[model samples]
Target: MRAAERELMARLPEGALMQRAAAGLAAACAELMGRVYGRRVVLLVGSGDNGGDALYAGARLARRGAGVTAVLLSPERTHPGGLAALRRAGGRALATRQKEDAAAVERAIRSADLVVDGIVGIGGKGGLRPDAAPLAELAEASRAAVVAVDLPSGVEADTGEVRGAAIRADLTVTFGTHKPGLLIDPAREYAGSVRLVDIGLSLPDEAEAEALQHADVAALLPVPGAESDKYRRGVVGIAAGSSRYPGAAVLAVAGALRGGAGAVRYVGPAGDAVIARFPETLVSDQGPKRAGRVQAWVVGPGAGDDAQSVAEVLAQDVPVLVDADGLRLADRDLVRARKAPTLMTPHAGEAAALLGVSRGSVEAARLHSVRELAERYGATVLLKGSTTLVASPGGGPVRVNATGTSWLATAGSGDVLSGLAGSLLAAGLSALDAGSVAAYLHGLAGRFAADGAPMGAHDVSESIRSAWRDVMS
Candidate 1:
């Protein structure tokens, strides 16, 4: 953003970019408040461009007859021009660093109709400083609607890690482009609904991360042609389930049936169970290699200690998806040696086991953990969580899945995801695309199945067609 800002600023007039941003911010604030006039607005100003954005925006609100107050964290270092504009527009300013101004600061924030968090910008790292941490708490406790400038204060812009105190905003008005922190969670949870204010900054085609929207997913979804047959469409092989966990095989096949794959071939001890649940699935008592001609293989949902099965599936030349028990049993050396694309899906616990780190660490730093896992495994990784992330082994832009709901956290959910993703792999999408697209569809299915309530893994699988149709429409 700094580079793009520098490039744009060199061509445009001084302060024009800030003005463009402030105008949009003020407009959004006005819309949120419904009426700007007589509304009390508080700006948590710091010593940076973010503070400048809030101050300038506050000036706009003050001009429209709203009561605007600036609580400057660094009064001496505040943006001079912005302060002057606010003061000129009949807005009041209070310095929080002063011992005597604490009461006034608290009172103003508590009574305000809106609180604009400009205490820190995207450049600010770690967390809020001692002087400003209290403001974040106050904003949280207040009845006012909180809006963050660019992003919530103290979030890591490059990664979504929130080390310490960060403001929880009802809205975040960002300029130029959406920061990576704004999309990934922990920080995404801080930044509520985001409103991007374009300042005409020409950014590069490549980005650190990307999110696939409805149109993007729709474009990638496979549609059958008139001449296309079942074999041509693609067949996915499932090497999962054991004597004790036959439901895993059943659920995996359930997801695969709705996952755009023409045929699903099952090879496991749970053949009768799978056949009972899904008769269309070609059942095989033998191993993966003998499971007929499969375009791709899904291994390790409930193969419980079946190292041979996992190894056999990994040896296949076709694309392979490793999940659940497979993630643990599959050899890293064998996975790295495979010529075909390998996609590994692991939750925080599974991922931690692979990286030899605490699950908490993986959950906290999802972006880093996913990337590191992909690099270490020499394969594509889908880190499943509240925010599912797909990282490619080659390292380009990691895809973040935004369609997730909390209700999706249920038993056998990963098994369903494994089948769905493997089906996509068979349909000829790249490992990265298949993982990301499956996550997107799965999340949407979870939302539809749950629909504000709890749902089983089977319910999620049943709703995949609904999600597919919704995305296509």
Candidate 2:
């Protein structure tokens, strides 16, 4: 982003980019207000260009007959030109350097209809400072809508880490492009809805992070050709479930059935249960080695105490997806030694176990944790949570899935994801593609199944077809 900004600034006249950014921000704010003529707008001014943007935007609102107030955090360092512009347009400014001024800022914030958080930009780190923390709290307490400039104050732009008090904006109007924090959670939760304003800056072809959309997933999904047959499509092997949890086997198979696989081969102790629920499954109790030929293998879901079977599947030449109990039992060295593609699906707790970190650490730094796991395991890692992330070894942008609901937190959902991704892998997609696409479909299915109500894992599995069709349509 800095590179793009520098290039654009070199070609344009001084202050031109700032003017464009302010104009775009003002327009978005106007739309949010419905009518800005008589609304009260407050600008939380800082010591940088972010404050300049807010100040100028406040000037625009003031000119349109809105009551505008600028609460300056650093009176000495505030943008001179922007402050001058706001003053010329009849916008009042108050400093936080004095105790009386601070009190007045709080009163102004509580009564305002709109509060623009320009206190900190993307460059600011470690949350709000002591002097500015109270204002952020006041903004949240206010009934007014909060709009952030560039990004919400105190959010780590590149990592999505919120260390301390951060501004919670009802809407964030960012300049140039979307920052990584706006897409991932922890910080994403604070940035309510995002509006990107183009400032004619050319971004790189590949971003550090990416979110998949319907069109992108639709294009990636496999479609059968005229000559395609069950064998031509691909067969996926399932080494999952035990007597204690045969439901995992059923749910996994359910997801595999809708994952574009030609057929599913089931192996392990739950053969009778598998055949009972899904008669079409080619069942065998002989284990992964004896389960007929398969293009890919999905091991682990509910394979309790089946370390030998997990090891056997890892030795196969085809792509393998490891999940649930398999993640715990599989050998790290054996996983790293595999020449074939390996995709590990682990929730925060499992991920923490794999990395020797606390679950809290994994949840707090999801982006970092997923990438580290991928590199250490020398395979693709799908870290599942609020914002599911798929990271591949050798480093590139991690694919983020933003379609899921809290309802997906139900049991057996991860098993379904495992089978679905494994099926995609068998059908000729790369490990990364299979994992990301499966997460996308799984999240959508969860939403469809739940729809603001309680939904079971079976419902999510059954809704996969509908989710797929929704994407295709």
Best by TM-score: 1
Query: Could you tell me every candidate's TM-score relative to the true structure?
Result: 0.99, 0.98
Q: Please list the residue runs of candidate 1 whose C-alpha ends up more than 4 Å from where it truly belongs after superposition.
A: none
lDDT of each: 0.94, 0.93
Q: Put down candidate 2 lDDT per residue, 1-473, tens digits, no spaces.
A: 88888899999999999999999999999999999999999999999899999999999999999999999999999999999999999999999888788778888999999999999888988999998898899999999999999999999999888899999999999998888899887898999989999989998898889888999999999999999998789999999999899989888988898899999999888888889988999998888898889999999999999999999999999999999999999899999999999999999999999999999999888899999999999999999999999999999999988899999999999989999999999999999999999999999999999999998999999999999999999
In model 1, the clashing pairs are: none
Error of 1 at 19 (Å): 0.5
Report the C-alpha lDDT of model 1 over 117-181, residue by residue, as the tens digit.
99988888888998899999999999999999999998988899999988999999999888889
Could you tell me how far off, in angstroms, the CA of residue 368 lies in candidate 1 after the best superposition?
0.8
Q: List the residue pairs that clash in candidate 2.
A: none
